[model samples]
Target: MEDKIKIHVLNTGYVEVDEALAFKDKSYNPIAYTGLFRSNKHKVKVPVFSYLIEHPKGNVLVDTGWSVASREDYKSHLPLKGYIASKPILPSGENIAEQLDKLGIDKLQFLILTHMHVDHVDGIRDVQDRAEFILVSRDELKAANKGGGRYIKELWKDTIFDRFDWNGEMGPYFKSYDVFRDGKINLIYLPGHTAGSTGVLIKNNGKFVLITGDAAYAHASWENLELPGIINDKVRTLRCLKWIQKLSKADNCVEILASHDPEVKPHIIEI
Candidate 1:
């Protein structure tokens, strides 16, 4: 096995929404997350990120970002509810498939989806056949397949995905899956953002780095226990945020990243 794991953080595109969508405000407006019914001044744009993990066993891609079709016409690529809530801005050459091709990555051992949100899985069509296995947590798959809100089946209707349950004990909730059957890579359950939202944890020697996929929208989400505007369960969101905060303080944790933190730029993280 390789002595180190290299994580390439790629910014595939951007999503424009109300500021409240990224960080909830004091107002309990149910539709605050949707940019509609709000002033244009409240709009904020944040980058959409995906990770490429170079592991000794195999290469894993987490959450394919916006598709080129979105850049052309998001309305045609996304459902009415989705396009209304958030606007996707994918620049030329930023599509997930385009990035992979630029990196000379024609295939992947695993393609994992943290959750089935439109911005995260819309590009599945571009790389579905490139992966040997494409997976999502059983709970997430069940929730997404219901086909409502942001979980639209149109995003992955033609793609086949394997579902895996969280059977291993690890992380804050003791609910995780050891992806490579080794301690190096793990999928930690972090619900609330979705029924089965997941975070990726990569460990090497005594160091570790966590990819918090929308479980925590930004550093402040965990640091201040601030919740995002869209949430499935308030209690679960709080629990996940608190645990992430604690995990961030661990000596072994080299880094903890959020999926759409504007402050985070595309870079490489090694563990």
Candidate 2:
């Protein structure tokens, strides 16, 4: 029998942004997500998470957390506009490289990124040598390379990306990529958060765990069908949330984790 897959939920750092950015409401502010010119005084601090998947085939890491440089000077670490969008809070030993070192993860077979958001990809600099291949969705890479708004080209300029396409329909929107050509680990295209924002579906021993990387910000995101503040396509976001709602009800669904949920802590989930 194959060993159970162990998923380590690692919290690299935290980001403080406007509450609107995490969950959308009736507020009509167009640039609320940017944390600029918003009338609302509400700010929220949420943890940025990275996942280490111990699969039978190979070890995989999903997303890279904040870089250590941000801890010294966030202003210099990010562009002026990017700094205003989301302020990073990285303490000593909270970055991906330190966390990976503590976990004794010397190398990873694949580094699968859910999107190119600054918070998700900024830590790549720390782990570039640790991962053999870095993977991103084809559409995501295109959008990131275009360089506008939240996608900062500087963050991943030196990083070479291996693009993967969706070849089958297994999740919402009828788009999913079986990473290992097996049903155990799949990448579900949950766009709208970004051009190619993807979620992960991990199955082991007849159980499932879904990692919604900003596709839904928290359990309440799909529970109340509340869309995230920043959305490229409102229709697609809603569709993805609805599918998440349905899947959460399945008996085989062990847990659904959101990347920045304050309630989710660093833990090991074996499925």
Candidate 3:
């Protein structure tokens, strides 16, 4: 077997979202949290993270996090004519490229995007030319072109993606591709957060870590079974959540990290 891979959680930046956007049943709508009609002065800051995996075969990254330009002005990347999408907030130099540079890494063998959310793909331009290839699910490419507030394709329209495919079912939806042809790094399909939203399941040091990108707001949501406000399908999202919860209960799942969960700080897992 190949040597275990190391997983490093990189803090790219954060987003300031309406309380309703992260949690459901927390607003006047009853079935929702916050939106234009029930908008409130309250706000929640969620951290943005991208994972760096060190494998003997090659280096891999999951999600690009936020764009560097966002550090200057969070609203700069939004296409709403200055209206922010998720009201991203970041300090200067917290971008993915700089973070990767701090570790003395230059090229990425595989750049896996969890979904097309603005925060996840904004930094692609920074490493697009250097990375060997940007990989994303086939369904994600189609969903991004479907027109939505978060599916901003302009950031990475020029980059070619090697759409990773899998034909069997793993949990609630279509099966996942154990990228690398090993069980250590599996791209689990847990749709609903976005049409093609996916997460990474990594094995290291006899423990498995699931990096759930916006699948659940935080550990609390998954622990308490609370659904987030932003979703493509509530039913499917719930099923996905249950699927993850089931995995968490297993002895191998050491932890499940949420992309924007401030509670889960960045750390390195030795394998």
Best by TM-score: 1
Predicted structure 1: clash tally: 0
Q: Using alpha carbons, what is the TM-score of model 2?
A: 0.96
Q: How do the predictions measure up, each by TM-score? A: 0.97, 0.96, 0.91
TM-score ranking, best first: 1, 2, 3
lDDT of 3 at 52: 95
Worst 10 residues of 3 by lDDT: 28-37
lDDT of each residue in 177-242, candidate 3, tens digit only: 877776678888888888888888887557788889889878877888888877888898999899
Model 1, span 1-271: residue lDDT tens: 4578889999989999888888876454777777668888788899999999999888899999998888998887677887787888999999999999999998899999999998899899999999999989999999998987788788888988889988788766789999889888899999988889999988898888999999999999998899999989889989988888988999998889899999999999877
Per-residue alpha-carbon lDDT of model 2 for 1-271, expressed as tens digits? 5689999999989999888888888464667777777654677789999999999878899999899888888888888866687889898998999998998999898899999998999999889888888989999999988998788899887898889979879888888988888789999999999989999999888899999999999999999999888999999999999999999999999999999999999999997
